[model samples]
Each structure stands twice: as C-alpha cells, then as structure tokens.
Target: MFHVALTGLLTGLALIVAVGAQNAFLLRQGIRGEQVLPIVLTCLLSDVVAITAGVAGLGIVLERWPSVLPVAQVLGGLYLIAFGIHAAMRAWKPTALTTEGGASLTVGKAIVLTLALTWLNPHFYLDAVLMLGTVANSFGEDRWWFLSGTLLASLLWFFGLGYGARLLRGLFARPSAWRVLDSGIAVLMGVLGVGLLAH
Candidate 1:
C-alpha cells in the first residue's frame, strides 16, 4: 500500500508540476496577495472530484461516448485562446506592483476564474481523470490508497503554490518582472490552446 501510494504521489506531481494555465493564474493571484484561499480550495476540490470520478469509472463512460473529449477539447481550446489573448494584453500593458494590492479581483471572481481555468482545460480531464483514474484502478483494492496519495499531492501543491508564491513578492515588485511573467503566461496559454485545437 505504501508503495502504491508513493507511486500515486510521484505520478501526481509529474503531471502537475508544469507551468500550465492553472499554475499561471494561481501564481499571479498569489503574488498579488488576493483571494488565495478560495482559489487554492477550488483547485484542490476540483482535483478530488475529478480523480475520484475517474477511479469510479468515468473513464469507461468517456470511452463509451468517444465524442465527449473532442467536444471538450474544441470548447476548451477556444476558451484558452481567448484567455491567452487577454494575458497577452496584460503583458503588453504591464503594471507596476503596488503594496496596496493593485487591481485585485473579488473573491467570487477569483473562484470563478479558477474554476474556469481548471474545468475548461481538456488536459485536466486527460491527466486527472483518464490517466490517473486508469492508474488508480490498476491498483485494484489498493486504489483507495493510491487515491489518498494523489489527494495528498494536490493538497501539498496548492497550499505550497498559493502560499509559497508570496515569497516572490519582492521579485515581482518591478514592472518589468510583471511583463515577463505575463508574456510567458500568454505564450503558454496560446501554445496549449492551439495544441488542443490541432490535436
């Protein structure tokens, strides 16, 4: 069981450690010191629901309706493109960081954006649902242990990301740093969005 759990933890980290749309958004919010709690919880809960659903055989259902993923991909791709454009605009018009928490978003808005970024990404389903689900189910009766391990991975990551980002506040204090970060985010989103569409 411990071995199985360890496998789960490593797998989860491998899938999530990339600089994806979700991470980009969270990093921005964390640095700005805005609505971090709700965003982190939303991400963690989304992972729990997705991973559990996958282990409970959502993958089988998806296989039955093969069109589901493609449809999601198309929609998610378009959404990502639009979001990428928005990020690019931010990069073009960079803002200096302020101690007053400049241009902060409301908690409700932050949660909504977090949900959209999480759910509207086709890769989320691929990684969290189908891939993780298939792997967990392979653990047979110990799948729950695997599931627990994955959950722990998510818990550690989100809390660490959300809170740990605060450590970079000083670095992001410069306007140029903000521009560079937003530019990277834009490029990441655009590439991911196009990849989904072209896939």
Candidate 2:
C-alpha cells in the first residue's frame, strides 16, 4: 500500500509539476496576493473532478470517441491565444505591486477564469484523466490508495504553489518585474496555444 500510494503521489507530481498555463496563472495570482484562496480551491477541485472521473472510466469514453480531443484542442488553443493577448496588453502597460495592493480582480471573475483555464486545457484531461486514471487502475484493489496518493499530491502542490508565490511578492514590487512576468506569461500562452492548435 505504501508503495502504491508513493507511486501515485510521485506520478501525480511528475505529471502536474510541468510548467504550464494553469501553473503560470496560479503563480501570478499568488505573487500578487489576489484571490489566492478561491483560485487555489478551484484548481484543487478541478483536479479532483478530473482525476476521479478518469478513475471512474471517463478516460475510456474519451478514447473510444477520439474526436472529442480535437474539438478541445481547437477551443483551448483559441482561448489560450486570447488569454495571451490580454497578458501582452497588461505587459505593455505594466504596473507595480505594492504592499498596499496592485491590480484587483473580483473573486467571481477570478474563479470563472480559473475554471475556464482548467477545463479548457486539453492537456489537463490527457494527464489527469487519461494517464493518471490508467495508472491508478493498474493497481487493481489498491486503486483507491493510489487515488488517495494522487489527491494528496494535488493538495500539497496547489497549496504550496499558491502560498509559495507570496515569497516573491517583494521581488515583484517593481513595475519592471511585472513587465517581465507578464511578458513571459504572454509568450508561454502563445506557444502553448499554437502547440495545441497544431496538434
């Protein structure tokens, strides 16, 4: 059981730790100390749903009807492009983070954006749903244990990322830092978006 759980935890971390659109957004939120809790919770819940659905056989459904992936890819690609454009605009007129505050986003808007980023990314389903699900089931009777490990990993990672970002707040106090970060985000989104579309 320990081995199974460890495997699941390690596997989950391996797949999720990759720098991607979702992580980037969360990092930005964390650094700014803006709506961090809601965004983190949204990410955690999204992972739980996707991972659980995968274990429950949603992965198989997707595999059987492979056409679903392309549609997701196209939509996700376009959405990412649009998001990138927004980031680029922000980068152009970068603002500094202050101890007092910085740009503000309503919790509602942030959560909605979080959901869109989470659900619209095809890679999320591919990794969390299809890949993780297949791996968990391989453990047979120990599948639930594996699932537990994965969940634990998700919990730790999201909280760590969201909260950890606060450590960088000081570094981002300069408008120059904000410009660099936003520029990077824009580039990342564009690359990922085009990659998705081309796939």
Candidate 3:
C-alpha cells in the first residue's frame, strides 16, 4: 500500500505540477486573493473525477484499442505546443501583476473559467484521463491505491498552490520573475510537446 501510494503521489506530482492553464490561473488567483475557495475546490474536484475516471477504465480502453492512443498523443502534442506558444508570448510581453488593477472576476466567472480551463483543454484529457490511467494500470490490483496517491498529489498541489501562493506574492510583484517563470513554462511545455510528437 505504501508503495502504491508513494508511486501515486510521485507520479501524480510528475503530471500535475506542470505549466498549464489551470495551474497558471490558480496561481494568479492565489496571488490576488480572489474567489479562492470555489476555484480551489473546483480544481481539486476536477482532478479527482478525472484521475478516478482514468484509473477506473480508460486504461483498458487504451489497451484494447491501441490505435486510439496515437490519436490522443498527436492531439495532446499539438495542444501542448500551442499552450507553450501562448506562455512564450506572455513571457515576451508580460504585464505587471498588480493586485489593485487586475480584473476582479465574479464568482460565477471564476468558476466558469476554472471549468473551461480544466475541461476544454485536450491536454488535460491526455494527462488526467489517458496518461495517468495508463500509468495506474501498471499497478494491477493496487491501481486503486495508486489512484488514491495520485489523487492526494493533486489535492496537495491545488491547496498548496491556492494557499501558498501568498508567500510568493512579494516575489511575483516584479515583472521579471513572472517573465522568467513563464519562459520556463514555455520551455517545459515545448519540450514535452516535441517529445510526444517524436515518440
């Protein structure tokens, strides 16, 4: 069980702690002290449902229809590349992250955006539904335990990011830091995207 849980946590972090739309939005909100409760819950719950679905049976589908996975891979790769480009653009032309001047979205708008970020992105499906599911299957009967671990990782990350971001509020106040972080995200996303296509 420890092994399964540890595997789940580590693997979960590997997938969850990436530069993506959901994460970036969460960080921004965290810094702003906006509608954090609803947004954090939405993100955490979204991951729970997605990761659970992936572990439940998506892995089986991929295993049975090998052809399906390649398509997912291609789509995921393209999406990542596009996401990377967006991040790169942000890095190049970063706006000052001002607590006072940024758009203060309504609760409804925050929830709507959170949902869109989580569900609309094809990469989310590839990661939470296909890739994680595929990885969970390797644990055999212990896959559920692995799922739990993965779930915990997501749980921790969202909470940590949502709440912990305040600590970095000072650091992110400067545009240079944001630029560097965005640039790093762009590189990471680009590399992962290219790796997917190459594979």
By TM-score, the best candidate is 2
Off by over 4 Å in 1: 96-102
For residues 121-151, what per-residue lDDT tens digits would candidate 3 score against the true structure?
A: 5567778888889888888899999999998
**What is the clash tally of candidate 1?**
0
lDDT of 1 at 75: 87
In model 2, how large is the Cα lDDT of residue 159? 96
Which has the better lDDT: candidate 1, or candidate 3? 1
Best by lDDT: 2
RMSD of 3: 3.9
Candidate 1 per-residue C-alpha lDDT over 108-147 given as tens digits, one digit per residue, 9 for 90 to 100? 9999989989998888998999999999999899998899
Off by over 4 Å in 3: 62-97, 172-199
lDDT of 1 at 145: 89
The TM-score of candidate 2 is 0.96
Query: Between candidates 1 and 2, which one is better according to TM-score?
Result: 2
The root-mean-square deviation over C-alpha atoms between each candidate and the true structure, in angstroms, is 1.4, 1.4, 3.9
Query: Taking the tens digit of each residue's C-alpha lDDT, what string does model 2 give over 103-129?
Result: 688999999999989899999999999
TM-score of each: 0.95, 0.96, 0.72
Worst 10 residues of 1 by lDDT: 94-103
Compared with the true structure, the alpha-carbon lDDT of candidate 3 equals 0.79
> What total of clashing residue pairs does each candidate reach?
0, 0, 0
